[model samples]
Target: MRATFMFRAGDVRVQNTPDPVLRYPTDAIVRVVRACICGSDLHPYHSLPETPGGTTMGHEFIGVVEEVGADVATVKKGDFVIAPFAVSDGTCEYCREGLHTSCEHGGFWNDTELGTGGGQAEAVRVPLADGTLVKVPGAVDESLYSGLLSLSDVYGTGWHAAVRAGVTAGDSVAVIGDGAVGLLAVLSAKQLGAEQIVLMGRHRVRTDLGREFGATEVVAERGEEGIARVRELTGGRGVRRVLEAVGHLPAYEQAVGIVRPGGVISRVGVPQYRDAEIGWPFFGKNTTLTGGPAPVRAYIEQLMPAVLDGTVQPGRVFDREIGLDDVPDGYRAMDERTALKVMVKP
Candidate 1:
């Protein structure tokens, strides 16, 4: 089998690797059918130091179950399944509370130390099989693969951001960043009945898709200028909910500036900085700061129906596709801002 690995910054390669096998009673081997590179993957691609064997890449994927351990009951051989980015014991207390990302015995994909392989490959060793994989009901059309794949990460993540921000009917919300997650946040906000959705991004192509997703306005500026534009759009009062989809410091600062008094700011983007502002500015406004890794496993079932029925098209974020061998090129396209999101067929 072949899988993607990052030898160092700007060096991603699809290399030959041994096939994965079930190592635990709760594990399953999934032959990846669809996978993609995530924006978060770019973090390591930008600054990871050289490694002897390189590190595995990718997290989001939907595949056909080729094998399952004796203890696995929810899914069996030949079942098409969705694997969340994180591995969790479904029976844990946190999972019962819809916070699978915080499960007592949970971890992420590509944890080589834990013997887990990357999704951008021919197959992956999915630990906590019954708890981590969701079977797609019945036969699925090939056209829906990308949409179903989005639920594994980006779509669920966007839903998490909106849910954490407490988006409600007739409320106004501002979403920062125009990445896949940010655009999906716009879609989620619309579904939650947000009356106004402001998408802040610099790219015209992505922002246009954001508009189609539900952004009532687009603010392409940054810093103070962007903050003022959002304020002006909301009648100089800022929005009640600010969904920060970009993990950078500037994006967070903009969220602080655009959140109205007594509002909430949900950050779903993986944080890239160490420290952030949490002083008088947020304190004086009584703003609530929330959001994290987005326990996407919890939302998969809730969001899958819409994708299956074609009610929503969150997969529109995927602007390009490549074969398993072209993963290196996929990473470069995403890193260079030439692709909104890249889908992989292994």
Candidate 2:
């Protein structure tokens, strides 16, 4: 098998790896059909410490089941499935409550301890196959592959931000960042019935797509100016919900600035900072802070219908495509802001 590995910052390579096999009763072997380089992958691409053995890269993928262990039942050979970024046992307490990310037996892909290799490969060993892989019913055209792939992470992640923020019909909302997740957050807000969706991003191409995704307003400014502009748009009261899609501290600060009193700020972006202010600004306004790793496995079923029916096209976020061997160049393109998202077909 050929898989992606990162040896250090700015280093991604495709190398031959041992073929995956069912290692546990709950495991499954999947032949990768499609995978993607997530925006979150860039964090490691920027500054991961050197690891001689290299860290496996990627988490989002959709593939076909080639083999399943003795205990696996929910899916079988030849079933097309989507693997969420996190692996979990579907029978766990947290998983039963739709919090699969907190499942007792769950872990993320590429975690060395779990040994579930990265999704950016020709095949992967899927831990907790019954829980982690959502079987796509019947045949699906390749046209919808990107949309189904989005369910594995970005779309689900953006949906989590809006859901945690409590977006509802007629509510006003603001989204921070213009990345794939941010644009999808706009889509999620719209689907949840938000009346005013303000997208804060500087990229013309992204914000334009955000508008198409239902952002009623686009605020390209940053810092105080950006905050003031969002506030002004909302009649100086700010928005009722602010979805902070960029994990940077500045994006957090912007969320604090544009949220109305008693509103919520949901952060889905992986935080890059160690600490942030939660004192007067949040406390005084009675603001609520929420959002964490999205249990996308819990959301795949709910979101898949729309994608299958063509009601929503979240896959538009994938503006570029690359083969398995070009993943290194894909990283560079994403890092250089040359591509919105890169779809990998192995």
Candidate 3:
């Protein structure tokens, strides 16, 4: 099989690799149909150290079941499934509480001995299929691929951010970031009934999409200026809910600065910073901070119906599509900010 491998920073390739097989009774082999290059993948693509064993790429994927292990009764051969980025046993205590990302037996793709569940490959070994794989009930077509793929990560993560912020009907919210997840967060905010949603993003294309996704305003400013712009738009009251979708200290700082007293800052960005002085800013505002790796599995079922019925179209976040072989090019485009989101057809 041909799979994507990251040898080091700035080096990504699609080359021959061993095909995955059902290694455990709880595992299922999936023939990847649609996969995506997430914004967070840029973290390692630009900073990862050299490793003899190249890492497999991609975490968002939807595929057809080519084979299933003996104990995989939740799905069978020929079933199309949506596999979340994280692999987990469905029956874990944490999973029951809808925190699959923290499940005792959970792990992310490409971080395990089975060489991660390389979704960028032609096929992948999906563990805990019953818990991690959600069957796609909608028709399989190019039109639906983007929405289905979003269920695997970006959309779910954005949804988590909105939920954690407790976005309610008629609430004013500001989303920080114009990336795919951020754009999707804008869309999710609308679905949750936010009356005024402000999106902070610099890219014209992305901010334009953010408007289409229901963002009432787009602030192209940054840092203190950005917060001032948001405050101005909200009549100096600041927003009740602020979403920190950019995984950096500055983005977090802006989030803390703009949230009104007693508001919440829900962050779903893969936080990279180690420490911060949250005592003064966040606490002084009486803010409630929430969010982490989205338990996508928990929300897939909750959001699938909307995708199937066309109530929401978060799929608009993906702007480029390519084949598995063109994945390296996709990476370059995203790494250089030339594309919003890159989807791969294997």
Candidate order by TM-score, highest to lowest?
Answer: 2, 1, 3
For residues 164-261, could you state the per-residue lDDT of candidate 3 as single tens digits?
89999999999999999999999999999999999999999999999999999999999999989999999998999998898999999998889999
lDDT of each: 0.94, 0.95, 0.90
Clashes of each: 0, 0, 1
* Segments of candidate 2 deviating more than 4 angstroms: none
- Candidate achieving the largest lDDT: 2
Q: Residue 342 in candidate 2 has what lDDT?
A: 99
Of the candidates numbered 1 and 3, which has the greater lDDT value?
1
- Arranged by lDDT, best first: 2, 1, 3
Q: Whose lDDT is higher: candidate 1's or candidate 2's? A: 2
Q: Which ten residues in a row have the lowest lDDT in candidate 2?
A: 107-116
Q: List the residue pairs that clash in candidate 2.
A: none
TM-score of each: 0.99, 0.99, 0.98
Q: What is the lDDT of candidate 1?
A: 0.94
TM-score: model 3 vs. ground truth:
0.98
